[model samples]
Target: MDKEVIGPGACVLRGFVDDPAEMVRAIADIAASAPFRHLSTPSGAPMRIAMTNCGRVGWVNVRSGYGYAEVDPLTGHSWPSMPAIFTRLATHAAAEAGFADYTPDVCLINRYTVGSSLHMHKDRNGFLKDMPVVSVSLGLPATFRFGGQGNGEPPRSIPLVNGDVVVWGGPSRMNYHGVLPLEAGVHPLTGNTRFNLTFRAGVVKPAPRLGSKTG
Candidate 1:
């Protein structure tokens, strides 16, 4: 795989996935247990992208706030167990990006179609900030915006295609980043859809059971 350094402690691994078809099948199985749904922001605006998760914990956002939850809010059950292939890819990608022994507890799967876009933002939830974030792209191609720590700096738009992986940590760990609106496209593996698998070290402590009182 070819590597391109986007910034300090950030890189893009071109065509990192050897078999996009296998990965797509895995995603379909994971989604079968934990189906994708649009999560709303704090203001109650539904995000354009449909999201789901697999692993010990899943990232969640509701009217109350955003954080990691041990259970799927929709089904009131634990998220599907992360597939072995997902863990292997994430750890290997993180290691290639200079973060060794990286083991993510959660994998957030984002589904985007034509016109779906994600606004620039920093990832600062309950996850361990020291760990690197590994993101894998599949299906249709899209533009990925990588920016600096401050908002004043203009972000660089990088074209990402199927099997491309991006990893960021250390100095670039908290940098602002997002994906631009997806233009019309049809990919053989996924038709008009694009799937992104984001791996992160989620909350260390187990979230309180739903509806349970906590201090």
Candidate 2:
């Protein structure tokens, strides 16, 4: 795998996964346990991307706000456990990006089709700030926007394809980033869709102040 530093605390490892098919199969199993759904935003609008979670805690957005939960509100059951392979891949990628002893406790899986995209945003839901985020891309391709910590300036666009892994932390931890709208395409392995796995380490803190955000 070729690793390139994209920012102070971020790097992308091109063709990191030798066998993406195996990962795809594993994802199928995970989805069977915790089905993907369009989670609602705080504003009550459905998210554009389909999402599910695996591991001890999963990212969630509800009327209450953004946070992590052990149980899927849709099913009232714990999210599927993080597969061993998933943990290893995330750790290895993080370590390669200069984050040592990285242990992520949650994996957020996002599914996107043509026209699906994530808006530029900071990953600041959890109490832990600046935790390293390891993202693996599979199936299709998309443009990634990497921006400065502040939102005023425009972002740099990068293309992410299957088997590519990107790790962000350190000085780039709080930098804004997002995926641009996907174009229509098909991949031999994933076909008509793209799957992105983002791993994060989080610890639930006390409820926020009245004016602060809540999950």
User: How far in Å is the alpha carbon of 131 misplaced in model 1?
Assistant: 0.5
| Worst window of 10 by summed lDDT in candidate 2 | 206-215
How do the predictions measure up, each by TM-score?
0.94, 0.92
- CA shift of 111, model 2, Å: 0.3
How would you encode candidate 2's per-residue C-alpha lDDT over 55-158 as one tens digit per residue? 88777764466677777766778889998899999988988888888888889999999999999998877646657999999999999998898957678899
Which residue segments of model 2 deviate by more than 4 Å? 206-215
Task: Note the clash tally of each candidate.
Answer: 0, 3
Listed per candidate, the RMSD to the true structure in angstroms reads: 3.2, 3.4
Per-residue error at 136 for model 1, in Å? 0.4
Q: Rate the local accuracy (lDDT) of all candidates.
A: 0.88, 0.84
Model 1 Cα lDDT, one tens digit per residue, 3-91:
99999899999999988899999999988888888877656667789999999988776335666788888778989998889989999
Instruction: Report clash pairs, candidate 1.
Output: none
lDDT, model 2, position 159: 97
